[model samples]
Target: MRLITQSLLVLALGVGLARADGETAGEFDYYVLSLSWSPNWCIREGDARDADQCDARHDFGWILHGLWPQYDRGWPSFCPTRHRNPSRSDTRAMADIMGSSGLAWHQWQKHGRCSGLSSDAYFALSREAYATVTHPDAFRRLKQPIRLPASVVEEAFLAANPNLSAGQITITCKDGGIQEARICLTRSLEFRDCGADVQRDCNLNRATMDVIR
Candidate 1:
């Protein structure tokens, strides 16, 4: 009888601990605006895929990766929403900043659904959030690949956006190269300090930053 009781208790606890595929929409603490360094991404993975964004014709620099709703600790994704999904034209319009319509659709399906908004509204908010931050011209002017401390990237961003502090942003690295710059914001889109988990910064002394195509 005691063993059966213990087993039942464990089962109950496991069920309670399990996370759902979809969280409730419109409930989150903050947002993370992720900007990918296009050239670095191209070198690492995009070029192999023959991604159009990597083409010299695009001349892409930092592109919008996603505008994600975040919790203070973890984040919500693929949440069920009452709003309708974006149409083909809607996603295509965002390609100018997002690099591809495919990314726009993916972002909407994953992160935007959790915003408690229609796809159009979510994309609009994403664009507005993106425009609020200035991409440092110094990076765009890079004539050749450079290896520099990852912290230099963060400092350049801070200089460009005076309202932003070190706590509000983080730089990430992958494949031995600079990857993305993620900035935290309030629900209202004002700059805010990131949660502890989101505040992890790449401490690379020399991370390669590829030149813009």
Candidate 2:
């Protein structure tokens, strides 16, 4: 039910982004934020009973808080208390996952060509960091993932979000030494939308996964 609801929200958002016409940037951000953050784990853990129970059982130092009367050692509950995520802060964990950033941000500055997609200003990052933020067409550099200061990216999205219509986007480069970035999703982008086979790669909840597709 949670996943289904988030999926519908994304469809509404994409539709809203498309046909809403003539809205302000901030308005767009506000709208998008709802979709971006919908499946966010940290944001919702406070309210979900299953989540709370799981936290108490596994995450909270393997301590059972006794709140969950039906707790079973092996049986899977709706919340699935079997596994617990160790770290919650997104950016830090992703950097660790990527295995030491093969591409240097500074290297991109010296040898990386614009190839007509990325802006020159995006080079604020070092070669290693720049290399980490990659999209499919990394060599052809056509479908490049954006890079900019995180704050810059956030503000730009926030600013232009309200006024956007279909096919419009606000781009920013990563700043603050791009070890990694976990953009605060105001709305949800379901993992399924990212990729059904690789939803775990995205580390998103089912709620987030629903809308991504």
Q: Report the number of the highest-TM-score candidate.
A: 1
Residue-level lDDT tens digits of model 1 in 141-188: 999999999999999999999999999999999978999999999989
lDDT of 1: 0.95
lDDT of 2 by residue, 1-213 (tens): 999999999999999876644222111111111111111222244236343322322221111001101111111112211222222332122222221122122222222221111312212222222232222122122132333333443343334344332222222111212111221111122111111211111221211111100
Q: Please, what is the TM-score per model?
A: 0.91, 0.16
Alpha-carbon error at 53 in model 2, in Å? 28
Instruction: Report clashes for each candidate as comma-separated counts.
Output: 0, 50
After superposition, candidate 1 runs with Cα above 4 Å error = 1-19
Error of 1 at 146 (Å): 0.7
lDDT of each: 0.95, 0.24
Which RMSD does model 1 reach against the true structure?
3.5
